[model samples]
Target: MSKLGQIGAKLHRGEVSYDFIGHRKLWFGISIALVVISLGGLFARGLALGIEFKGGVEYEAKVKVTDSTVQDFGDAVKATNAKDLGDPVVTTINDEKVRVQTKPLAQADIGTVRAAIAKEAGIPAEQVTSQQIGASWGQQIADKAILALIVFLVLVFGVIWVYFREAKASMAAIIALVHDVTITVGVYALIGFDVTPATVIGVLTILGYSLYDTVVVFDKVRENTRGITGSNRYTYSDATNLAVNQTVVRSINTTVTALLPVGAILVVGTVVLGTGPLKDLSLALFVGIAVGAYSSIFIAPSLLAVFKEREPGMQALNKRVTAKKAQLAAAAAAPVGVATVGAPAGAAARSDVQDTPRKADRATGAAPAPSSRPMKAAAAGRPQPTRKPRSKRGK
Candidate 1:
């Protein structure tokens, strides 16, 4: 088998694993740093909202053969030097059409802007079309999106908590989901990606995905830890680690499969179609899905273990597990079958029996008592039965 295949098999069987829970503080610090940077970017640069949200005027016109190129359209529009108007964004639609968008303008200034664009493009003034947008409509949409996000979060929290029957697991999953979103949005704010309605939908869609991945890991953890307290073989944290290790391959496979299509959409939409809703939606999904898978593997279970280990019951259980582990290690390291010189034969025999594993002893609440009779009968041949011939006559 390939090296990777062997590694995956080992991980699945819990024979090999990384100490994610043991090093959780480091992961926590890294996440905090990233979040802080993202927040800084958000406040410093802010997101570049699309015209639909900010309310702007749009003008589209077909350029004449003798017209200046689309590059000169922005300069020509700015040459009008109208007051209180933001810069115009000029883009080419195909080879013949140029589109110009700008902040909201007064009714009279719209005609002036349109005429300037037409003149620069060497097109008839009537060829340029203009439309005014109101900010109130955009505000309403923004409010509704926020409301939807809140409702979604509330519902996700309830569903996860109910399914897991553990508040810490739900809380960890929620935190991971929030982490995915915060970073995704931060990327938007930092890179100045346009926040369109499609972007909002992408953000909401990722929440469910992040939750799904986290829940899968938590479910495995729950299964591994069932009846775990009855013995000292493993602690809750160890069980959690095993669960994560077992599911790592599955998570990686799922994320890769999901990301392939998203990556294609992002590339095709951005490169071929240029900036549009498709690019916006795909970019958000790509970031969110990647981060979600990462958190499910490294962050969620670690947090769950951390939260659980703090309880008194878990602490005692872990203590017992640790003590048992130490004993086993010492036993493995010690020299075997080296009876003490001058010790009584019976004492040595009893010592050997005592050193045996205590699993059956613990379960049955007693050690095996020494037997007086031979384990096998002294004679190898079967015992002969004595028959009374007189019994037939009596019958």
Candidate 2:
């Protein structure tokens, strides 16, 4: 087998493992810090909503490519200074067209603005096209996007709850989903990315991807923790840590696979195509996918382990496992050949045998009374049984 396959085998067999659940505090702390920073950026900088979200007038002027074209066009539109023109945003589309956007304007103002842009670009007024977008239409789109988001989250919770029959798992998944979305939005706000309809679509797509990855990890956790209450070999946290280790490679592989194409689109859109839907959509997808993968692997399972460990069954199991480990450790550390004179040879041996059944019973939720019967002593000089000679046996 290849190196990676061998490592995966070791993970599956619990030979090599990462303590994700055990060191959950570190993960949670990191997430909290990121969330705090994201929130700060969001409240401070806010999102740069596109014309589709906040209704505005858009004008596309065809002109020769020049470094000063954007500044000149922006100045020309602002020179109109018509009512409600506000600030004009001018961007180049593939160095061929200058796209200008401003707040909604009256028909006369739109004509004036278009005329100014056309004169500056040395083109006919009719050559510069203008489109008026209504605020009500933008509001409707926003409302529907929010409604879709709500429905998606509700369905996700229901599906996870029904599939796993575990509310904790569902809640953890939802929390991770929210974490991914919030961080994505915050990053957009911090970086002043245009929040367009394409951005919304990308956000929704990443939610599914995040949930899918979380569900994969959760499924492994469920399998690992099955019948866990009856076994003192692993606590809920141990099982969860093992589950994360078993699936971490697959998660990394999938995330890398998904991010490669997204990274390409983001590069091409931002560099080659300039500002457009591709840039908006690809930026959202790239950030969301990366953050989604992190939350699924680090946030979701760790939270689930925390919730599961709070259960009474898990608490008892953890105590038993802890106690059993301590006992084994002490036994192993005991000095050999320490039996004193007159001490029965079988004394320590009998004690171990007597404790075995009790530990087994406790592990399996059984209550067995300790045996009070004294152990029989071993003969001081007992002879060993000898095997018969092969020749004598044949004769």
Candidate 3:
């Protein structure tokens, strides 16, 4: 690979990651500011709720229409005398054909709506095509979308729990997904895209992409950790580093390929053509896809590393490894702490737990019985000195 590519791989893998948690205070202000700014965007502007949620009529028609010259569809809807007629949306479906869509219409006005489309396009009422879906259709779609999101979250959580068999991995991925989804929604509100059924569909698509990217990195870590014995070369951190290195480029490539067409639609529909379905759908996808990629690579993987490092067992492992390495060097230099240390090296170093009495120690391997002291005092007190028997002390 090129030097830039190699450098990027290392950067994602924490080859350059500093003690970010140790410096959490440094980022705390930034994090809070971002969240507050995002919330203000959400609260002040509010979402542009689509016709589906607000209850609107949807019309689908195969107009015997060509792009060359046709009367304005908007003017036709205006002539229909339909109550609350929104701007009629238009686009081409295939060769020499077009589709005219509009917001929901009242149930009583369907016939007048029919007559309007016929008159506007200069076609016979029968020859011009149409179907009307009620505004309540939005609720059904919303319910299904909510159900799908919940189900997806549950499955992803369970699968991560099983795959990594590590709580840290699951939490890291879930939190990052939250970041992605929320940021996308926040952007939607800020930019004011109409929240259509297409938006819900876009968000769902983002969920799958986000989860897949997270799992790919996690899987790489798991595979790389076969014998991650606390060596200088191999640790939980190293496995994580390798995982990120392997996946960052792939994630970027996947996100770029998916967004290319969406990007095109965004540019053309908004700027050049001045209209299309890209408004309702592609906007959310564009934002969600970009955020999903970022969170999966940077936020999710970094959080996983941070979380696992905080785990007591993992901390203990690092302590043992460090202690062992130090003790080995000490043994070579002085040879006393080495001889005094136990066979298992770090096992017998229980500074917090008291030793068993001689009789109890000999009777069984378990620790000594408690002195019937109250729990609070015993735990609260400093270690008390105990006298040894005369015979054993001399020996």
Q: Tell me, what's the RMSD of every candidate?
A: 10.7, 10.9, 17.2
Q: Which regions in candidate 1 have their CA more than 4 angstroms from the true location?
A: 1-6, 60-100, 115-129, 337-395
- lDDT tens readout by residue for model 3, 77-188: 6677677776666556654455566666666676677677666656676765666655577678778888988888888899899978988888988887877777788888
- lDDT for each of the candidates? 0.84, 0.88, 0.69
lDDT of 1 by residue, 220-273 (tens): 999999988888998998899899888888888899999999999999877765
Give me the candidate number with maximum lDDT.
2
Question: By lDDT, is 2 or 3 better?
Answer: 2
For every model shown, what is its TM-score relative to the native structure?
Answer: 0.76, 0.79, 0.67
Deviation in angstroms for 250 in model 1? 2.0
Residue 391, model 3, lDDT: 83
Clashing pairs in 3: 56-104, 57-104, 57-105
Error of 1 at 105 (Å): 2.3
Residues forming the 10-long window of minimal summed lDDT in candidate 3 = 347-356
C-alpha lDDT of residue 47 in model 2: 87
lDDT of 3 at 298: 64
Identify the superior model by TM-score, candidate 2 or candidate 3.
2
Candidate 2 has an lDDT of 0.88
How many clashing pairs does model 1 include?
0
In candidate 2, what residue range of length 10 has the lowest lDDT sum? 372-381
